[model samples]
Target: MNVLKPLSGSTLALLACMAAGALCGLVAEPAGALAYLFGQLYLAVVNMAAMPLLVVATFFGLRQVCELPRPAWRVGTIGALALGLMVLCGVAGTLAGALAMPGAHLPEHAYATFGERLLQSAGDAQEVGVTLFDGADAAVSQTSAYGWREAVPDNFYRVLAQGHPLGILAGTLLFGLAFAALSREQTSMLGNVFEGVYRTLEIIIERANLLIPVLAFGTAAWVSAHTPPAMLAAMGSFLVCFLACAAVLGGAATALTARRAGLPLVQIVASLKAPLLVGLTSGSATASIPHTIEAMSARLGFSRGIVELIVPFGAVFVRAGSALYFSLATVFVANLYDRPLGAGDFAVIAFASVGAAFLSSGKSGVATVGYMGVVLSLLQLPAEAASVLFVTIDLICEGPRNVVSLLAVCAVIALVSAGLPSERVMPEPLRAQPQVRAPLRFALSRGQLALVAGCAMTVASLIVLMGIGVGAK
Candidate 1:
């Protein structure tokens, strides 16, 4: 067997391809068109896998969560904390983006460029709204990001093929829950098959990233050959907001860990230093897991089993980093298209972001950014066109994203291991919802848990539909 397993990524190959791409863009303008085609080929291949992976990953990941050997109360605590933390992170991002207006107030040229791309995503209507400022036609196209037809799938395969991220996400959630409900004995064989499939997709995508040079070159040449320079600044502004949000979350996580562990803030920071660095450099939470476990259990003195359980769970299931990124990024797109956001819009941004982050698990780099399609679709934003610019800056953003992921796990472990009791938070017959203040409280039964979950999901779905309906108008 081959030793070392090829280092598990194509980082060097990516660099080489990028060099070749840059060279082509600079020295061979005539051949630039050919390079662009190859890049398009790469994008198409990735998109083909992106949607399928969204489904398979969701199904498989949820099954694994369900299969945890822990008791029902433990599982419910994890679920509640993860969901609450993720929503908290997303809402924070939405606030930051709303106040900062990263995609708003762009310079004249950059504004027009994004506006055109927004209009372009409306395909058939693009002809009428050649410019974003084309009066009523442009106004109509901008508000058309959501509809009844798009939210509900008639045929799942067709919807997946059409690049409908929200539709795929909705379908996958229902399917994943049903699959997760099957006993391990019943799903043993199929589980192995999907596990293999998910791993294979990861490998394929990693290898495909090696050809990112092609995509990079094409994107760079296309931008340089056509657009003005101000677009770069627009992207930078968004990144600044993204990093700001990550920073805010990261600092809060550090504080929470210090308080929960009853350790000094300096000590907590020092203990977390290694994993934070790994996350910052690799931009992969999996890469940082070893360091995170060591920091939490070995250095910080949390229970080893709990540390192990919560770290990986936080890395994959929590996904607050992606949640934060999505909230800001989605709102950024809305502002780019000059779509106004009301209170309902912010609610949609926060809710859609958490859902999108769940599907975004196990993806990195281009694939991670590409999966923004889900949230964008929910908001009826132009995922296809907006992703073009977003992907160009995605690499620069990953470091902060990963760093936040590590910090989030630290905070989660602190909360789960010491901050709260390991009891279920079932729906009570109380007048007001007591679960809000102390989520995942002690002493709930299985039947009550199910009833509470059903009620929560029902209320959430109604809110989403209403928010979507309001935004689309």
Candidate 2:
């Protein structure tokens, strides 16, 4: 049985639910509305979990990286490259979308119709403006927004409008420091309690993860119900473009990396395709680890020892996709707020994206710790904006991210294992070797969950409040 079978099952169910919601809308109206609300709420919860998870995971993951030798350069180089690519993609993609926009006069209509929705989805508003269009068929009047927010929800608006989750995220940082401070060698009980808190958070995140699919289904169904055929059609093109961009970036990186490693890029990509697909569709790299490992070793000829060490290690530090997304997202959010980032801000963003990627892990739970904290503290960004901007589109980003990660890890494994005795080393004896498992695993597993959960919960709560609205109606 596939270790990620559970993840696959959930994803399938989500697809089914979306299909059902779409068709049900054609069959009737009211049922579609109900489906829409429930589906949306399901997504809401998932989104709820994402930010805090990112925050906590980031903190612990970074701390873990800090404990390693010579990781700064390895993690930093890949991260910087990933960040640069993402920023380029974001700017280029937005410009391309604007230049090639189908309807010249459609901007106002889009904004009037999708402004609230886009805000909810992307956490900011589009700078819609009038433009003249001279097409082959006819001259047309048009309005256009620069990015993907035109299709999302209202929660995004709330996030931008109010600086949220930042407060809660701030609180979590204080708590983490406090926990460490209170847990000096003398305070055994405090230390034990902190340890238990971390463990419990991991357990809860792991178990609660099972609910993601059910929620995903409901959300898809809801999206199908409310969105018109035309909107869905437009979204289809966007998804295609997004996937294409992700593939090109991933493919290029794999080829270049493989060339450097003297491995077959095709073999490496083919080995990772299913896992990459699963990861993209599910938007969870953590869930894709088992399959990634299997593909690396069984199909790609990596030793078990190498696969285990590099894959997991890569998951925490080499979040190529997340790094890309964060870079794009930071800029996109800034644009929405009408606070275009300057060189200094961009520099800070570059560093933060690298840090966030280092802090990110392949585990699904509580991985956002350092990430959430860093963004909120370093940037003048609204925390609620972060919560809304990427939640629904995570899978859209994860696909390429995982592929990049797969390639990066493959390179590392190839380099490391080429020097070793076995190209197919057993896991047991490999773990016994100091060169393979212990230090790596120890780095990944240390206090990762507690930080992830605490930060994620805090972010989620803020997002929920933004969507549901706080105080009065």
Question: Which candidate number would show the highest TM-score if scored against the true structure?
Answer: 1
lDDT of 2 by residue, 117-231 (tens): 5444544345532221223112101101101122222354353234233333334434443443442465566546544554444444344445444434444454455555544
Name the 10 consecutive residues with the lowest summed lDDT in model 2. 139-148
- Any idea what lDDT model 2 has? 0.48
Strongest candidate by lDDT:
1
> Per-residue CA lDDT of candidate 1, range 324-404, in tens?
998899989899878899999899889878877776665566777866766676666777677767865675677688787
TM-score each candidate.
0.54, 0.46
